[model samples]
Target: MSASSSRPSYAAVLRLSHARRTFGAALLGRLSYGTVSLAMMLAVNRATGSYVVAGTVMALFGVMSVLLSPARAALVDRYGPRRALGPMAMSYASLLAVLAAVSWRPGAPVALVAGAAVAAGACTPPLGPTMRAVWGEVVRDKALLQRAYGLDGVAEEVLFVSGPLVVGGLLRFAPPAAGVALSAVLVASGTLAFVSSPVVRGVRPTPAVKSARRPRGGRALLQPVVVAGGVGLSLGAVDLLVVAFAEQRHHGDDVVAWVLAALSAGSALGGLLNGAFEWRTNARVRLPLLAAGLGLALAAAGLAPGLLALTVAVACAGLFVAPALTTAYLIADESAPPGFRTQAGAWVNTAVNAGGSAGAATVGLLVTHAPLGLCFALAGTVALLAAAVPAGSRMPTPTTA
Candidate 1:
């Protein structure tokens, strides 16, 4: 047979199509989630005149989402993405609308705020799991799968960086209420789009074999999968330190926004590079080195002076961010039992979010009583320590079929 004839033909084209659709769905979901998140934070802060309260609300949202994520993922696994998206979107919109209404009313009860926070948290759409499951189904090639994940990671960074800016602009130039309303509309529309896509619609839940029963909590949190969760916690600490450091330097409250954007832009660049490179090293080796590099770069940022210096340092720190994240995803995918993949992913995400909250709260206290630079130094030091932990240990092999 001719070499050309031996190569796969239409199958390659079909895979590309599926990848494109998956990317689109991810993009829309992220954009919607980011926008609403930004708007909600801004609105809550404005209404309450207390960032502490706003932070509490945000934390509650994260906590609830984390706690319920597995359940949400289970819903998707059982009924598919189409059925899950509709209720999630509607619930999300309704909750936001109620929040807006309560905020507008004079002397709104604290209960209203608490209720809003819980509702918002509970209704987070199963975007991450759904997209991940789709990728698992559609992309058969390992390299292509990695590239797709890199792209998704980059997209997430972009959404977080840009989404807030958009909300801020709307709230500043237009009306705050308008921003909230816009967020609701975007989220609902995006959810609808994701559900309606043929690729998403066609994804049926795989039959669970007897061996793949639901895992007990302790067992699930053990294993290399949990180690990956630790890595996420380390990253979260790094992020918190970056923000606290920026705030301490009198870079303004929005300094976090700028630094985040710079870091995200670097991560996006890293993702693209990850796609282009054909690395010969195993993930275990590459991931630790990458994480260590990130730690060193973050340390440099802690020692740097001024916004420009900090920005450069942040960007450099971000160079390894996406690679480390991709590595975590790969590990989680490999280590998780078949039926528990969604829960595994959720646990990773929850650990990251929880770690971030802890880091931020801790750093905030340190900065309040101690020097700002000290807070940055501590954060950088912790990150470096975290990076070293994985490096010193024997790396696990990537599991395969």
Candidate 2:
């Protein structure tokens, strides 16, 4: 495929008025949450002059967020985004203020900052799932939802990359207090804007959970959400591979950032192009093919003879990343019984997080003994499995109807 052959058409997706406002607010406001871990670490390390304390504090915050997300998402599923997320965002914003104020002091109390982080993480609105749910309500069209999810996948990638960069910049030029404060403002403001958007408020839960049906309750191996997360597991190895490759080659920090950024940039573009097309293919069929593509591309990345080859390979692999994720959401949302969409979304998030964490650990250990290509090979192999996971399994046509 030529370079110019894949440009995405963003017109149709962005044409919807409701999606425009909600997506814009959510994406912009999300930067604070996205950047918080790094910014908080930078703040604490700068203020207390200790990386140990900084790491510990952020670790508590992250672990709690990952652990608490499901329950919070369940709540949103139960009460709806407006009632659940609005209050949660406000309280989160308040706590962030306190955290920022306290962390700025000469010797901030460890317990207090930790407590604030815990509170914020536990109450943090499950917006990732919420947004997908909202898109269904506002767009009310299957094709558009695919586009929405595609845009969403791109936003997620961008958030992860830009969040750290934003914090890094603040740490270099601005005070840690400023970064924390800005994050608080962003969180509060974003939540309010998103929750208040007509699209989000209009979201209605699928009928009751009692009426909803799925294979093996929500934990089935063949479930779309589960398979999607397996993709996350495979892709997680991509980052570790990039870092390891950069280090093995003795590239500097700039190259490290650029290499990682390449994956995200590629994913962003792929998502755009993927969403642009209205495919005739079934979701189940598409899922595995995309996963296979991702796996093979990543494998090629590992085998690249040089930096240029690796860049092209990584970019090629990224082309499938967001589409795979969007398809997972499509399947999961379809598979979710009436009224359980939010919980299903949370589960997807959980599976991805858990899988990614585990893959990173495994890759890190193996990198010490194996060639970098071996890591890529492992990722590709797992991705192939992820593809097979839903191939013959019980699956309905992915649809909101």
Q: Name the best candidate (by lDDT).
A: 2
lDDT by residue (1-401, candidate 1, tens digit) is: 11121223333323465455556656776686677666766667766766887778877877887777767776776667787778987898778778877765335566787688688789887677667667656666666666666766777778877777788788667645456667667777777877777777777755445455423222323333333444454456656666666555666767777777788788788876775466788665676577667767776776777888888988887777777766666555544555555555555566556656666666656666766556555655655555454423332221211
Model 2, residue 252: distance off in Å is 1.1
Q: How do the residues 114-226 of candidate 2 rate in per-residue lDDT, one tens digit apiece? A: 78877877777777888877665555566767777888888888888888778777777777866778888888888889988876767754545443445533433255555
RMSD of 2: 5.2
Q: What is the lDDT of residue 224 in candidate 2?
A: 58
Error of 2 at 43 (Å): 1.8
How much is the lDDT of residue 295 in candidate 1? 64
Clashes of each: 0, 1
Give lDDT per model, in order. Answer: 0.64, 0.75
For model 1, what is the alpha-carbon lDDT of residue 5? 19
